[model samples]
Target: MSQFSFLQSEFAPVYEHALKAESAALSDPRAACFYARLALETAVKWMYERDRALKSPYDTALSALIHEPSFRNVVGNALVTKARIIKDHGNRAVHDTRPVAQQAAVTALRELFHFSYWLVRTYAKGAKPEAGLQFSADALPKTAQVEATTLARLQALAKSFEEKTKAHEQAEAARLQTEQARAQLEAEIKLLQDEIAAVKKANQAAPDTHNYNEEQTRDAFIDLLLHEAGWPLDQARDREYPVRGMPNNAGEGFVDYVLWGDDGKPLALVEAKRTKRDARVGQQQAKLYADCLEKEFGRRPVIFYSNGYEHWIWDDAGYPPRGVQGFLKKDELMLLHQRRTGRKSLSATDVDSTIVERFYQTRAIRRIGEAFENDNQRKALLVMATGSGKTRTVIALIDQLMRANWVKRALFLADRVALVNQAAGAFKTHLPHVAPVNLITDRQAEGRVYVSTYPTMVGLIDDVQNGVRRFGPGHFDLIVIDEAHRSVYRKYRAIFEYFDSFLVGLTATPKDEVDRDTYSLFDLERGVPTDSYELDEAVTDGFLVPPKAVSVPLKFQREGIKYDDLSDDEKEAWDALEWSDDGQIPDRVDASAVNKWLFNADTVDKVL
Candidate 1:
């Protein structure tokens, strides 16, 4: 019932302070004040390190603590005698009628180790002994009864702490196991990257020079990704995951599957392409999706374009190599041929003007859609490539939710203005039947799919939680954070934890090697789903176009351009870039060193 209990966990600082007090009373004043400080420091040192809680009796060094005046008064003579027994030996050796030899100090140090052991056996892990110098429970006299009660209470506390220790150990073990699994996954991914590099090394394949329509290729590539790296298909080929549209204009648009995890929210408009043909064309189609989609709920929709053969992933945020990608080295790699295929490159006109679609379902899309529609409390992050009809797939989801009446209201968020503007336009164009649509922003808050920027949400959370002047609770029933990769921060996390919004996030690139903060958010928010079929289904079904990788025998075509929008740390990286003997990157470049580098038009302007 105490205020402090509600405010914070009490165990951390209490034990530390008590141990400090105990040490100060035990150190001998005979040595310099330095020795006293040393004793106190040593006693408390175990606090910084792990002290095994042994069940056996600690007979020696513990003597100092138990025999001290304060300890004797608190405990009893029996405990004091145990401590004194060992102290007596050291005393004899040091105080004997002979010069104190090197052996005396060595012997004292040995006794100190025993004291350290006792420290671990006792206070270190809260290990309780059967009996110790304690207040006797016997109601024989005033002092005895008081002593007994004190010991009884201490015994109970010790017992409670032991249980807590066991729980702590189990939690730690689970965490370590999770970490190990992650490490193993990273290693496997690295191996796969090496394999891809080896394959690309065989021949330098040039970029596709094609004059083609969008649909066939997008479907082809999606199939490729699914076939190569997605999961198996169900016997029914999975029934339709219905897309429902809410009447509230705020809740417009139909959607397919939405995958939720601790990672944030992702909405997927999934569709599996049959992996029957070459996957090259599919990739191009998926890439085009980026041009059409808009931002939603301050995040971007990730396009997972995979057929049963190859996977071509894209994100509304313009990030590539999304799901499972590895850097393939080119020296031994087959360089992408610089051949000029008579085929012409794609023009903007060739790309689909409509990024967000209403309804399109393949077995893969249906399965994912079903998952989302059926999922009760999970928040999802949907990934697909640019040209792939992620919008269309998500539309089905919206329609399904409305039809089910599961959603009272929904919020659509996105990563950027141009991107979300596409999402907003989609609602206006397709779901016009739904009335009273609202758009949420720093300045405006209306709409079922509340679209805004990640920074805006983070800022709003700060306003709500800290003593900021603005903010009301329960902003939305379902919060969809678009461009989730860019929106993770302390404030964003605070809002999610502080409110009860059914959140769903979407992105093309689910994982990024850079900006670990995004992954950290994923771990904290979504405890990695047990059923994940990204790599397999895409490969088996021909949705995403498989790569015809041509690793150029070059380091890189200049580490592309660093985007103007960057976090604080990224800006620091930008400010420090150095070139090698030719155009390759160097290891380090400080501010002063960067200024020294001469720039010429012939040289690449940006650093990796």
Candidate 2:
């Protein structure tokens, strides 16, 4: 291979000139010296560009470049001195118009070869450089393959860049179109604000007038907003429809207006009241009718209340009522329903039954999974004793949940690192084919199942709070907090609220303070367990060994002294033997007094 092949693309020109200088040394010393100077200039320029700190725009002197700290650090004094000698000799050949001696040219070529070798070793990384480089014409690259290969690579890069630029231009065009649409929407909002301001000004000027006809005002407001929202209000609405489940207090309470979808079923209920009443005044009545309508129909309709001048909308899906300028279109209401209900709809029957499960574990999974179906609850606690195979049971639960598609990702948290690692190991043992992610050292918790210590989660929470890392509240579908009693506390409470996922807390010590806090977190009543596999039941079922307590008594201190048993003088002496605040007798107590008044030394020694 050619010596130039060892150098990188950036140093290719220097390599080429050095090789040429070596070749021309004997036949033409002046030409050889000129090429050597070109080679040094190219090398210095490469070094300057590699470290931008070395670039001196004001000074272009070659001597100044050789003296630079960056250059000297890399090349060292020996190489720098040799470079100077070569530069001086090359300058004489070029400026003086004089021919250099064969010896001088050969020496310059040798030094240039050494510099090339050093550059290649430092920067080329993998290529091998010739150690015994000499002034030989035969060593120069004579083939055209290198030039052809470089040209082809450059052409490919240009094509790649052109494609990227076209894609960028398309994205820019789409962004501009979106910006224009936003600007138009902003203009419309401004117009609405101006109209509301004018009405407020008129109302303030004539507060006691109240001369507007309520029916006409209601019809006018509804008509204007419906037209703006692209709804045919006249055809889309049914007037005076009797609610199916509502009490007939006023001859079958009639709904003001029920908006229908394309399928001729109710999509929303709009309770229109007189302009004198507030919009919120109709909220309760609207909610009552919505419940009645939902019972009659399979799905609940969007609840809306309007007092002609203002309108508000409410959905039973936990979102509170909010005032809007206009009603939601039929299509918009359907989209909202889909988003709220279709988010996490997984059936228990979808679980894979091929995997084995303990009887207690199966029961726990059934109960907890059913509870997940309840819309009112989002958290639960599994109270299983320490040796009752909680980790194995949770792994089985996770497996079923994964199969049923209830949880796409889950976080397994523990207070201690060892417990977290143990849990991770249990998962690997049960699902040997699946790999678990370790969040403690990985900087990120990835994969379907993530295992982490509570401290690591705190760090992640800190990062998210400071805006250094961005993890959405709903990133994880489920969070299983192991030893939940210890993990959920005042200092780390934010970790629970930051995630909008279903929580399952597992703990052995779920009583007293822990039990109260756990219940409060899950919003459960006293003495109600979300899922319980108690120690007694586990022992009875042959799942754990029965625990036994042993008591031991000391012979010497079998019967300790009592204050009531002492004589009046002994009691006085004992009381006078003053002790510390902690109720420990002072060391200053007389030994003879202790032997005579207090217990014997043997008893005292045994107690100590």
What's the true lDDT of residue 475 in model 2?
A: 53
TM-score of each: 0.29, 0.38
Candidate 2 global lDDT: 0.64
Report how far off residue 338 is in candidate 1 (Å): 64
TM-score of 1: 0.29
Q: List, residue by residue over 182-251, the lDDT tens digit for candidate 2.
A: 6886676567555544543453353222222335435544543453344545652377777766656563
User: Each prediction's Cα lDDT score?
Assistant: 0.36, 0.64
Q: What C-alpha lDDT, on a 0 to 100 scale, does residue 508 get in candidate 2?
A: 88
Which residue ranges in model 2 land beyond 4 Å of their true spot?
1-347, 350-356, 432-434, 464-468, 510-514, 550-608
* Lowest lDDT block of 10, candidate 2: 462-471
Measured by TM-score, how close is model 2 to the native structure?
0.38
Superposition error at 274 for model 1 (Å): 61
